[model samples]
Structure formats: structure tokens, C-alpha cells
Target: MRCRGLSTLAAVLLLAGGVPARAAGPLLVNGNGDPLVWGVNPIPFNPDRGTLGTLDNAAAVQAVLDDFGVWAAVPTANISFTNAGALPVDVTVANYLSYLGVCGDGLSPIIFDTDGSITDDAFGPGASNDILGFASPECGSFVPPQIAEGVAVLNGKWIDGVDSPSNPEIPLADFKGVFVHEFGHYVNLDHSQINLVEGFDDDPSNDDAVATMFPFLATGTSTPHLDDQVAVSTLYPAASFASGFGTITGTIFRADGVTPFQGAYVIARQVGDPRLTAVGYASGARYFPSNTGGPPAPALRGLYEIPGLPAGSYTVEIEPVSHFFTDGSSVGPLDPPAALPGLPEFYNGANEAGTNPPDDPTQSVSLVVTAGATLGGINVVINGFPPAADDCSAATVISTVPFTAGFDASAATSVASDPLQSCTFGGPNQNGHSAWFTFTAPADMTLRADTTGSGYDTVLTADTGSCGALTEIACNDDSSGLQSSLTFALGAGQTVVLEVASYNAGASDVLLFHLAPVLP
Candidate 1:
């Protein structure tokens, strides 16, 4: 979340170079196989600057890999030593090996030790590598240390200072988000082309900005933007298991009768059985957007190509940058709101409002793909969902909500402010929306939802399957109570349903929903 300051400015001015030539294809290493994948075992600083929780942090990191289907094996090298006297050379080598599945070929997914030193090295030059986190000429761009075959050494200093679950400098909950970005690079993802035009310079522009593999460091606030997931999935498709893969293509439009919303994110996910096999996982399966191009130009109709998918059923969901405002008004550009509290001032232009949140209570559409078939014309019609006057006065409100595979409103333990809430949503009453949303699940998956809000008493639910003979996941009638998280198991070829129902019925409120791959 920190910038390079005058030093970076001087470097850019001195170079005066145009944007680097965009690679036409995947970055090649040694002209042989895919790019050499690597990993980091962040070294810790003496008297660690922040808190450390091994299990939760590891879970967070694993979640990132699981989402992208990145094949990361258990670490092979020994990286237990943490003394400052010992350089992080071994630690880096070991971590990279782990990512390569050197330790065990069939490892589901693993999270290595997030040493403090590694975290620092990721952000900037510390006792180890000189690369700066989220800055141009990053550590990975430099000559990576060489230790073993097919392994590259990663400096932890930059990452140490940047923030992670292993480091207490920032919120531990966000360690997975930052690691997701770094891991994207480990799998050969580069800075988004959009960052170049945004004048982000050497450092990342926004902490909470979306993009699974965004170039920025962790702010413990940002969620994976639509582009982020699409890129990753494009590189790896979940449906690759069946004989031949299928393709789903589509355009996104505003359901509110506005112009087509360019730069929006369209994600297609397999509905049933959130659990994905480890094999063929890292090859860019279930997740996309991050591994592809950067954010599209404003008003520019962008074409999305999702390839390398296994033939099966899928639900495609399109989410645009959505922001919330107190009064009903047009959502502004992606820039940070000029006026807001506890929010930074910067805009990346990815906003979704009006239609549905990732967890909206409604099932939009469905698609069935046969092996080797390229399905097209899967268009999305986004419906704007602004908050009601009474709903705006509620005690708890969420500005931006990340799209998770399984979202249970009753199980929502806490309500955090949407980091992307710019003035565009038009005050409290106005909010963002999603184009038509779709999700694919196994035929036998069970879905459920509930409504719980003090000021607002309604909840929306939707999906591809009918809610006939379904069980109630959870219920909280007390307005003062917090929302609970929902849990459901979906099977392949099954559809989930979403609909809206009022809990208290004092005032009608709107909820948004989108679909994403559920990590096993």
C-alpha cells in the first residue's frame, strides 16, 4: 500500500521509456516449457512488527491457490531457520520447489511458512533481494537467485514490508489477497496493462482495488475484481477434466436501460461439486481474468475469450464496478469517491451497482456445454439495484462485497464497508448492480439463504436450480443480530436458485449476487 516516492519518480524520468512491448503469447522461459514457477517462504523480522497465526494465514494462502487452481506442492527444502545471520537463500529455494510440486506430485494444495523476512523482501529491498513490492522493476524482474533445478529464488524483504498473515503490519485477514497477486507472478502473470495508463508508476495504485493478481500490495480491504478472476480462469479452466473442453463467450449490457457497460467482468463457473481435483488444476482451470489482459478502457467494448475448459455445465456471471451512495444518482467513474470516510482517493474504474451482488438472492441464467463446443451469445443484462431510503438508515451496511463460491447471508458474521463505494452509487440509497449472473453446480447440490438486517428486513436469493424441498440454512430475525454465513454442497450439472424475501418488511431493500468457482 506504500509508494516508491521521489526515487521511483527519478527512475521513471531517467528511463523515459514507453510501455514495454506487450507479449503476444504466454511469457516464454528458456523457449521450452511454461515460465519457471516459483514461491516465497517469507522470512520474519526480529521482534516481528505484526501478529502471526500459522493456521489461518496458511488457510488464506491455500484459498488463493485453490481459487486459481495453481498447482503448488508442499515445500521440499528446509526453511525453518529464521536468524538474521542466515540469508533467505535456502528459504526461497525451498518455497519455489514446493510450488513446483517437487515434494509430492499429487499434493492437493499447501501453504508454506510465511517467514517475516520473505514478507519484507516482497515489498522492498531489505536484508535480501532489492526488488520492491508493487513497484516497477520488481524483484521477480531482477535476476532471481538460482539454487535448484527448475527453481528460482524469491526475495522476502519486499513482501515482508508489504504485509501478510505472517506479518502483523497489516490485517491478517488480507494475507491471502496479497499472496494471490504474488503467486500470479509466480505462475507468470504480469502487471495489468491498465496499470500503465492509470499512471500508477512503480507502486500499486489502490489497495482495495479488485483484480486477483493486481500489481498492488495488500490493504486487507481489496477484493478480487471481475477482471482478476476472469484472467486467471482464462489461463486455467475447471471443466478441463472431461475429454474435450468447452468455451463460453458473451457481451455485457445494463439491465437498467443504460448504455452497455464496457470493462465489466464476465465470469463462468461450474455449478456443482465445488471440490476440484488437483491434477490439471494449475494449468489455468477454474479461475480466469487475472492471467489475461488488464482492465479494459472506459466505454470500450471488450471481447472476452475463455478457453481451455472441460466440457460440462456452467453459469456465467457478469459483474461491473458497483459503488453505493446515500442519494439516488448516477454512479461515477471508477476513481475513488471525492468525498468519503475511511476510504482512499484513487479510481481504477471497475464498478458494479444496481443489478446484484455476488451473493444476490436470485438465479439468473444457465448454460450447458458439450465437449469441444464453443458457446457464444451468452450476453448479460445488468440490473441496477439502489438501496431504499429506509434501508440506507440501517445500522450496518456493506459497501462492496466479494463474490465467494458459497455465500450464506445468515452466516455472514460481519458487515464491512465496501472498499469500492464511490460517489457513483449516489449516496446511501443508490448502489451498484450486476449484469445477468449464472453459476453451474452438480445436479445434487443443496442451496439455502436467510435475511437479517436491523433497518432492512429483506433478502434476495437466486440460482439455476429450483428451491423445491430445500432446507432452511439459517435464520436471524433480530435486527440487532449479525448475518450468518450459508453453506451448501452443489453437484455437477445442477442449478442453484436465487430469490428475494423480506425478513421484517418495513422497507424494501435490494441485494446483489454473482457466481464464482468454489474452491475445494
Candidate 2:
């Protein structure tokens, strides 16, 4: 578990008591095994930095104790935490650098940044003052590594509530919520994405998620949500955890019925309470297929597992990551919808995905699960095409010239951090979340592909032939002020593939995929 930086500013007051989040998506725990033991140093590592809403020594330390109690109360988890007493401050060390040494030393020290010194080291100097706290873990490998120790870092700018109520910058409740979140990382849980409208709206129109593991939570929440419990139990399951829970294993398919749909999101919601949902992804596959071993298979790529579920009647819901992409740092809505396209559906045996409207629960399939039994073959199919092309194989069938479409890079993964097709206009590897579009020559023609007025830095690439065997035609890094553009010639009946990506990885930009004919 590495240190997770705050997604948005620290001022976010995301809490709504006792309401479990709908998406308890896991980041594939970084530890080798489960049941990590954490001991928080009850002392303040750094003196107050004197910011607007900093928590004092007594209040800060107490918050950690109270927050740890939240997780300690989970019945199914074998995890237990201890207040390890005050940590000895390093006299030789002047700033937050001293606390950095504690992460790998097998000591989980809950530290407070008296000033912005620690944050400056974590992000950079003069960064935003919004981040309240962070958790650092020892990640040996890229995916699911052994977590050695976790060090929690809190911003000392504002002495938050319960410490000093008069200084009303950040309430004590908010700080406590932040502590529980970072602590989730401390114990080996990772971030998850749930769709909810942020800012001034207490009620979300889409899906309102309020889990400790969610990137951002609603304000006034204190306890661990149901999804969080499922994750913790899976990580550190007790004796009854096994007998009390069941597992769901399944695969996802494309409209063609062959291509393995990899990145789609699948959830099993309790028939009794839809909000009590457990989520996983059909992710065993990568976007790019390899020819070395053999061709791709559905079982090899499209697989999902939702374990530690309570034995009950449940309904399965499937949705694409196109609208809500999980980036490295945060998870939330993708850049405004760009015909990203994937019909969300309940597993009712048919393909046209649909959700059981929030009011109606019996509208979908009610899957029965017995404790310790794995229900398999609950397959799903996604048929609708994205407004833009999905890949060279299923490129959007386009006929109109100067066509406009949308692109989202939140779900993008870096196959190659560098440019794969061209170098001249190649920008950053933002191409990780690349989108595809293809067109056949109306009659020998030249066309220009442009992503202008895009919110983020954009890049474009052109190719010919199948995705596995692509012939790069042209590539551009930046041409229209942080946007991307390129021109290529297309012969009659020749299908040219166009790719749109961000200049930086994980950046979702709202823009048009404009393909206009090049006039002499």
C-alpha cells in the first residue's frame, strides 16, 4: 500500500451517516496476505503549522483513536489496531522528512504536518492547501504487493473541530471521516469510484455512494459502510466470515459474442437493500492482445469475482467504465459523456442493459446465493456501439465527414508510456485512455483529425488495418494549443483508424473528435 494522495481538496465534507455506498470497488489490495496489524503513534510528530483549520495535539490524537474504533467494531474482520503511544520525535530532523522514514521501518506512525512541510514533500512546494490527510504504504511490486507499514499524514494548516471549535475552517467530524479513509489504505484497502454529484447536493440523482473506501465521501458520516465491511472481511476474515458469506464469479462478452469485454463494471446488490452492493470488474484482460502465446479467450480476459457477500437474494447489474473511469489517484465521473457508449443492464439473460429504477427493486433478476457457495456463469453482454470507434476491429461505422464525437481517458491504461504509433506530434502517454474512430474513403480523399477546445492536452494517432496488426499512418502530439490534430490520406474503400488520447495519462478531457475532409 503506497501513500494515496487526496483526490480533491481537503475541504470536502463527504459524510452521510450509516448509509453504505453502492460501489465498494477494490483496487486489488497491495499486500501479499490479509489481516494487517496497525499501531498508531498517539503523539504528534510535528507541531502545528498554524493553518486555518489545523487539529491540535490532544484533538488530533483523539481523532485517530476514535476513528480507529470505527474499523475495530467490524465484526467479521480479524483486524485489530493499537494506540502505540507517542512517537519519539527526531531532534536532528527539522521538517516532515523525519516522518518519511517511518513508512518502511515496520512502524505505522500517524503523523501531523505542523505546517505544509510534509505536503510540500509529498506533492510539491506551493501546492493546494485543500488536502487534509494521506496514507503511505510499502508497495514492493506494482500490483498486490506486501504492505509493510502505513504512515498517516495530516495537514496541520487548520486546527479542526473537537480540538478548537472556535476555528471553524474544518469540523472535527470531517477530520475524523478523512482519518477513517486514509486508515483504510493503512490496513491494505485501496480506493474505489462511485458516481455521485459533488457540491451542494445532499441527494444524488444517479448513484449516491458513501463508503470509507470511496475516493470522496458525503459529509457527517462516521461509521464504515457495508461495502467497506465486505472489503475488510475479505482482507482479514474471521471464522464466521467464511460461513456467513458467498461468492459470485462470472464473465462478460461483446455484442459479437466473442470479444472479451474487459473493463466493464459488475455489481451484485442485495435484493433486500440495493445500496448494500459489492462490486468487481471484468478485468482479467488487457486492452491490447498479445500474439506471442495465442489468441485471446473470454475466460482468459473477461472474469470478475465478488466475494464475502452475505447469503441472500441479489440482482446483478453491469455497467461500462466509460462513464465512470477510475484513474490512479481518484474515481468519479468521466469527462462529460462523449457517446462513450455501453448500455448498463441487469443480468436478465438479455443484452440491452437496464437498471431497476431506484424505486422498483423486483424489475430485475433476483439471484439467490447460499453461504460459501459460488454462483457461476452469470454472464452479461454489451452490444451498443460507442459514438466513436471502440477499436480498429469494431470501429464505429461512420459515413459523415467533419463528424464530432466525445472521448474519455479515465479508463485508459498505459500499454506503452511513450508514443506507440508516431513521434513527431506525440504528446505525453495520455494515450493510455485512447479512443478509436475509423472511416472508409468516400472516394480517394485527404482528411484532418482534430481534437480542439478540449479541456485537457490531447493527442491523435492514425493507423491502418487490424488492432493487433496496425500500420501507423500519422501521429500528432499537440497542434491546437494543448489539443491534437493530424492529416492523412485515405484511398477509396480504405478504412483508416483514428485514435484520440490525453497528453497526460488519466486526464479526462471533454472535447470533440472532429474529422473533416482536407480541401485543396
Q: Top lDDT: which candidate number? A: 2
Against the reference, the lDDT scores of all candidates come to 0.30, 0.53
Candidate 2 per-residue lDDT over residues 110-148, each given as its tens digit = 666655456656666544254556663432222222344
lDDT by residue (tens digit), candidate 1, 375-444: 8755545444333212111312222112312112231221122112111212221122211123455334
Please state every model's RMSD to the true fold in angstroms: 17.6, 14.1
Residue ranges of candidate 1 with Cα displaced over 4 Å: 1-183, 186-243, 256-258, 274-302, 320-361, 391-520
Cα miss at 212, model 1 (Å)?
8.2
Model 2, residue 193: what's the lDDT?
A: 37
TM-score of structure candidate 1: 0.34
